[model samples]
Target: MKQKSTSPWAWVPTLYFAEGIPYVVVMTVSVIMYKRLGISNADIALYTSWLYLPWVIKFAWSPLVDILKTKRWWIVVMQLLIGAGLGGVALTIPVPDFFQYTLLFFWLLAFSSATHDIAADGFYMLDLDEHKQAYFIGIRSTFYRLAMITGQGLLIILAGFIESSTGLEPVEFSVTTQSTHTEWVVPQAKSVTTGGENQFVVTQADVVIGLNKLNKIQADSIKDWAHKQNLSNGFVIKEVQLEQAPGWWSSNVATPLKESLKERFGKEDKSAMFKGEVQGNIAAFGIRLAQMPEEGENVVLNLDRQSGAKDLSLVEGHRLTFNNQNWDQQAWVLVQADPKLDTAVSADFRGLSGNIPFAWSVTFFVLAILFVVFLIYHRFFLPRPAADKPVAESKNMLNEFVETFVSFFKKENFAIGLLFILVFRLGESQLVKLASPFLLDAREAGGLGLTTGDVGLIYGTIGIIFLTLGGIIGGYLASRNGLKYWIWWMTLAINLPNLTYVYLSYATPESMWIVACSVAVEQFGYGFGFTAYMLYLIYFSEGKSKTAHYAICSGLMALGMMIPGMISGWLQEIVGYQNFFIWVMICTIPGFLIIKFLKIDPTFGIKKQ
Candidate 1:
């Protein structure tokens, strides 16, 4: 084998960055995809969740990858395959209707990504020398964290933008209903008949509903299903006159004047004028015809006058039948009816000019169209970052650790590799899985009641910087001292992030700033603690089939995340968000116990000898 001096620090960062990405994409965002695609929340959690199975169970097959192929071949093949999968995802993302197909596409990508990890880690061991590997440990860890950040952070932002802008069109919509009530308040006409002394009844028809009954107990029939409903039946039979005459006395004088005319004038005397006040009652309910001719079919209102009349000479009698001449304003029908029968009323008319306000419609239509156009070009058509990374030589820190990364995955240290995988990414995966329902659920639902914007800020902006710092520092410490020296310290760092959620659950702070800062601090601990685990894997995978060994480690890591995540939704569903975070804290104890097994010499990062 040809030997040349190489820098381990140079490649580790980007390599690990590459390592973390596919898992986040396949596992995490897939959950998000089904949700936005209109899948029911429960179905989104259940169906999309299956995508994690490949990673959880990938460990069993990782050995085959190690024993069979060149690390170089596996790396390139898996990378190309992932690239193809991403392209497929872009194509298939159009229809939220097909979730199963989309999830299958993602599974393909995960399979490729896991295999890539196996091959890529192996390539690292074949390439890097021990001294350089030790020095570059921090560098590798940083890049991998960046990859995770990019998957969860950047991709999510893009998806959100897409979701907010798609599928809107031009149409008109609104709601209008006529509220009606019927009441009889002492007829309001100054005792037209004696009060309660005698019950007057009229000759009825052949039990048919009559609409023209004025002297037949005059009242509005808009009340309800009763051909013989009792009077004063909760129906407010009242009228509101908008404007009144010049003087109040004019109304009273007119009533007296009417009596004088009747007394003075003979039965046949000629007098064209008659005076009276308009009684305020439920303004006659009858056919209200529009003043103008309707756009289409005709409207007709007919009156059946009393053929063998006794006396049709009452003012209320006249009001019982009305026809409006104004086409625009409808004529009101004050006809009385037996209020006991169910009256079948129909408007017998059609169009409402559903032509909404033209200017508003145009404005919204333009805004929607422009928004869709911008995002479609930005996401699928226009190129930002090519979604997936290319398989190439990396200058990241983990790149240097490639040599020792093989020994980390040897069959001899299978248990350690599994442990590191299971415990290392536990906090990150669990937190990511748990945060969604808490933020999106309503306040009454016993959550903190933050908006999507709040979640993005707390988990995204501040967490980014602190997590970067922690990862960098932890990576540096592990590289400088040794795995044993820093393993427990890093474990403490990672597990402590869970406590922030505990604090958040207990303290329902109003100030978003306070909540945001707390989340960031916790994420920082995770970043720092995660670095030691990455270094250990690299250390163990160094000797033979480094990439295959690393892939096994990565598969175990996926299992750690998948199991907790699968049940996390159920837990939140059961105990609610507040109690769930406390449970997460309880789970952290197991991780700390596992950390006790890590054996790091004091001078571990300084030299591999």
Candidate 2:
């Protein structure tokens, strides 16, 4: 008796949707999360880009899926594994050392997702006949694109929402200080206040300043004076009340102090100062104190002479007091202040906020539940076809692997083809790495300064819809006119629209419309152009063991994306976002050059009509 066939409609959409999720989460979503968490562009690009390893080498293990269990079994198993991996990532994200720990789960997701791709594609072939396969191919592509929306767009939008609700803010602050000094004297005392509380509380009442004529102040005398005054190495300025400390607070607060000292004392002054005194001063006293001036309250320091010059009182001590009730509780950090210096000290800390960790836990928890749902739905609804005989015995596994590797290199124009595949998306790979970061970064930092939610609305939701539309239109056009005719246009589509970034970086437009339109245009081009690359991979993998060969092609595709992306952050840092985008456009030359030698069939992708 003939076996009854299952309808493709029941499972095809969900199958491709499942396939799209982990890949997007790994490749795209992780980048955004890291960027938002303030991981440097270089580290984010390098570390996350390494997650692409599994997809690049996945072709090496594709033969195992064919040789071991049935494709259906592998599909279900891999789906469950992917779900576990996603949950692992979500769980680890809120940890103290989340970057390292979360990366481990991302690797797991990447590898499992790649394996699922192999099995799912194989199962598609085995479960459907030629006519049904052709009929549902578009449907499969559509659902996969939907998966992109879900993963890249909807999930990111979800993350952006969670970010808003969770109360995660970048650690940053700024302080503006002004002082009244009639004569230029070295900085003697300073105090910092935060939220109406004295943070670096300096007991100015007991603080003393020693002032002597330059000729009377000898080196030995100064040393003896420092010792008698209980200045052990120097005064220790403690950070008393830290309302919101940024990540780099300790390292950066002293930077401005050092700069101020460098500006004040020339080379001669440096030589006259005690050995390592500059460093010691910075280490001992780095915190700045600023008190906003009050209308009737003038904070003044009055010094009274002791008895005579012989009383170890070469300098007079002053008691400085201020009424705290009249002062506003805004953020004010005091740096150097002189009773006579002409310059004012200003300290600004950007990207600092409350230390509240956003509610990312909820996002991941829901995702885990969603994956469980996917797992249960697939298990019950997916058809289990009769298992095909394993293609290789356990002993032949090594030989089959060798054949799979060797045969790919033996293809016609293989070297040129490989080069084309590798460089085709070189620009795009780098662009995608920093796209979210460029959007979320402050406008002063060469970004659009969009909020996390705004990034989701513009790039994820609006941009992805156009991307999906572009894919559909590209498919229709390729079917009508064939892949060969549209190859050049597709190549242009992939590379040219990177100009949107270049434009955004230059204009730094505040209007959301400009940003949204720009993202839409670029994403649409990406979707439309990507069709050629996919069709080309299919064309190249048409020979013996086409499935395995296609797997190899997919590996190359991943490798292409991986290598360029790994260095994109460092590159962006070297040349700011604006120039980095220009460099991306420049890198597209190789793709154009390689495409010249490709041998495509004129009618390969055309429809029967």
Candidate 3:
């Protein structure tokens, strides 16, 4: 058969772009989605971290791709499967068991995406000669990054836009702090009344909270009560109880399990609650709809500070969900004044009732359509190269695979090399999983309290730009000085800037620029330091069966990320974000320690003169 020769430009960029999307979506985007949907941080981290398993074990099945079918055939079929998996996720997001169903689909997406990676990478080598392969490496990387931007930046921005736009006319209110002391008294309960459907009614148009700090005992009492109620520390003037209890699983199974775990592992530091001399003053306001939502419809009220004094912040009630069963029940919004505030200052807050699931479902649907497009485009445009054929000696493939594994294990300093690969990103593996959740968490929980759009703008666009710049600079410097001279510096570059997250956790600064800059510093450090890690992998994978050995290293890298990420949320929930970041800094010690045992070629990564 005559081989078809299409321009590499026709397929390389698109192929890589497609390759990058599902990865970002499965690994990063899913974390953000579950957070917005009100899943507990522990659950989000644990379940989503499991999604990395496919990538971690992909090497085990990668040989099948070479043995069974043409690389092009695997590519086209995987894309089709990927599209179907995305569609499955989209279809399940609105169901009551959405989390379980979406995760099942995500597993499918993860495996398909991993398989596609092997096939795509294999096809790239088979279709291009050595020179062209070297030339297009940068092009392929650029498009992969573009895919990252689209998934992490543009798609998230789109979901955020829908979250803001698909809701009721937003209600804006302001709260002012007065120096005049008002006695802390619970407000009298008002008679409940029903209003028209979809009418969101606020009991108070605006509020005035006194600047008086509660005495330590009173403050401690209020804090304890609030903690018990799963509310922020505030003056609970009027208690609003749910009309109906939660489902049997929540009350019977999940709650008991959580309490038992909390008892065993979560020891709270009472002293930390009242760190300063004076406790902040807080007040609660009520919000309820006039009538119940229609069947299968849920109205979610998201409250955010619009424009205001930083001293006056919304501490709780950032998100409230109302359905037919609970539309009339009053939900409380807790506002807290800074301990240092003695003057009159006001902050404005806006609440919007957007359907959260619908927004995410639409995002997934768009992804499904995109993958379908990729499937169709690659099916026709991908060149049919004579070299892109299945292995002829299928029976010998298993032995070759076993030998590939044995060769890697027999390499010099194999144990040390394996340790280096596994421990290099110890701090990072945990941080990546919690960073978005920290941004989205409520102020009372010690997060930055950023909206989804704000996170997308800050972490995705601005942070990614700095990360890329750092990587480029790191690569150039490595080419000039080689990996040995720069490895320690790169190690410091990666680990030290993690302190930015520590500062962010402590300050929780409301300024978008401050948050963006912090994330930029951390991401830049990661990018720069990551260059050394990659160079080391390439160095370690040298000699016979280098390609297969490299794949094993990559799988171990994913395993390193997966295990730490799985526990990160559980740890964060126990110690809180402030301490969790400090722990991340402590974890970096091992990565630095492991580097001392590594032996590297002094000239590796240097451009030969």
Candidate 4:
């Protein structure tokens, strides 16, 4: 039977849109999700970095798609599998072993998605003629990016909204500071009382911290102790422990490790207590739930600076989780005022309780259903072309597979090309893994301290917009002057903007607009600089088997991203965010050094009249 002709518009956009969703969810959304769920940065980076494996090795199985089945058949089956994987992720999120189970599902999603990529790209060429292919390329890319915005921006925002709304009404508090003539002293503790049903209560609604000047020796000692605790700008947090014992891990493992560290360094100086003449003021507030949460329900408290003096910073108790077992236990919030503040200043903080796991589960459930819809729509609407069939010489498939890789390695300057591919984005690979975590982490931990919703708006929506504009402008300039002329400039564009992170780590700006604009600048530079990298892949893949070779190049690119990303979190913990970003800047040096040894066609990216 003769296949009917269908407009490329009917399926191309949706096809590519489907392609982008799983990749973003796996790469970007997973990072944010893990961070929010209280996974340590080291574990989040290491585990999620491993998720890139399927993509990195997908090229190895490309020949299977060609020999065993038709591309259209592969595409439909993979979509179904992808949907099932997403559903599995949704189901596992609320379980006790959610981390392990969700990762298992995500692995299934990754492999299925990678296979889908192989099939879809192959199907695009088979379904459309050369003329239509050229015309619809931009349309496909646009829809793919729309999928990114959907996953990175809208989906995250939806989760954040659900998180904020599903729990109890938010609690608010205020802190004020005043300079007093009398010597400053710590306030005496008062017993906390339970509130009415379903109410969350705080020990104090308002706190006043006394400001005073201390002798130079006392100030210096206090500063040293605070610095040792990762407190900065003259802030310190003091925990008031309850009578009940901590968990086994905290009692046995964590406590021992902390003691060892103190032994290795020096015992904390009690004499170094707050007695500063021109030092920051400190205050504490306590929170607890009046009633126990029902079985399987957990109340999460997230405290953030709503509005006030930019100088007021929360040094501890940014996030606390409570359930039936610990609903009565009180958690303390410690705030510090900058030493330079002499006049009265005030700040307000709001504590929100939301079901984070439920919100994320709903988000994944939405993705699963969306993919099912895609599977159904494409099952009916996808065009069948004459050339969309299995390869004829199935017997030679093994030989052909081996020859494809062998020939790629035989190309001139293959070593240089491989090295260039691996080293070009070393800094970027590490930065991408930790960027969201940096924004979401607490201020005391040397991060920007933004909420999930705030991160979505700033890094996802606004950053992506600037990223697209930068790419557009970069392409135009490269087409005008060619790749060689713009290579150095592009390299600088990608690496220099990393300094924005360095500044953010040090300055810790509280203004949303400032944070958004800084992220925009960095993302734009990344997009602009990435043009050179993509063009180089195209240039190097120019050969008799260009498609196969390009797939190989892509795998190597993913490998480059994977390794650095895996170790970034561990590195950040050691050096701190400020120094870690400076290290990223230092990593850029190798990329620049490699450029000096590269051989390129001067007119490669120039457009022909």
Tens digit of per-residue lDDT, candidate 1, span 1-609: 543433444345545665687777777766655533334456666666676666666655665555543555555556556656665665555544456666667788878776776655666555554444544555665677677777776766554334323322111111111124334322221112333422111121111222222222243243232211211221112233358655765567744664564455313322112111111122222122223233542222212222221111111211111112222222222222222112322111111111112221232233224334322432332212221122223434354345334455345647755776776665556677877556544445555766444565666677778877877677566666766777888778878767877776677677777777777777788777777777777666544445556666666666677787875765455455666677677777877776666554455556565
lDDT of 3 by residue, 179-268 (tens): 888655443334556644456777677788898987667656654544444332121222444487699987898677767866775647
Error of 4 at 30 (Å): 4.0
Error of 3 at 187 (Å): 6.4
Ranking by TM-score: 3, 4, 2, 1
Worst 10 residues of 4 by lDDT: 230-239
Residue 63, candidate 2: C-alpha displacement in angstroms: 1.7
lDDT of 2 by residue, 1-609 (tens): 877767778899899988888888888888876755545567878898898788778787887877677777777888888878777877787687988887888888899899999888777766654334434555678898778767766775576455434322322223222332122223344444356633223322222222221222333344344333322212211123437765574468645554564455312322234322221000011222244445554332211222221112212111222234323221111122121112233333222111213444456667667778878888878877764445666657778767766877899989988888899999999999999999966555667756555676887679878887777777667777777888899999989999999999998987889889999999999988987887777777665445677788887888899888987885675457777888899998998888889988787766543
Cα lDDT tens digits, model 4, 440-550, are 766656677665556768875799788877776776677677778888999999989999999899899988898898899999998788878877776786654555566
Shift of residue 419 alpha carbon in model 3, Å: 4.5
Task: After superposing candidate 2 on the true structure, give the runs of residues whose Cα lies further than 4 Å from its correct spot.
Answer: 1-7, 21-53, 80-111, 124-389, 393-395, 434-456, 502-512, 569-582, 607-609
Off by over 4 Å in 4: 1-16, 31-49, 95-97, 120-149, 163-167, 172-196, 204-283, 292-315, 323-326, 335-357, 380-393, 411-465, 474-526, 539-548, 559-609
Best by lDDT: 3
Model 3 clashing residue pairs (backbone)? none
Q: What local lDDT does model 3 show for residue 313?
A: 73
Of 1 and 4, the candidate ahead on TM-score is 4
For candidate 1, the per-residue lDDT at 341 reads 15
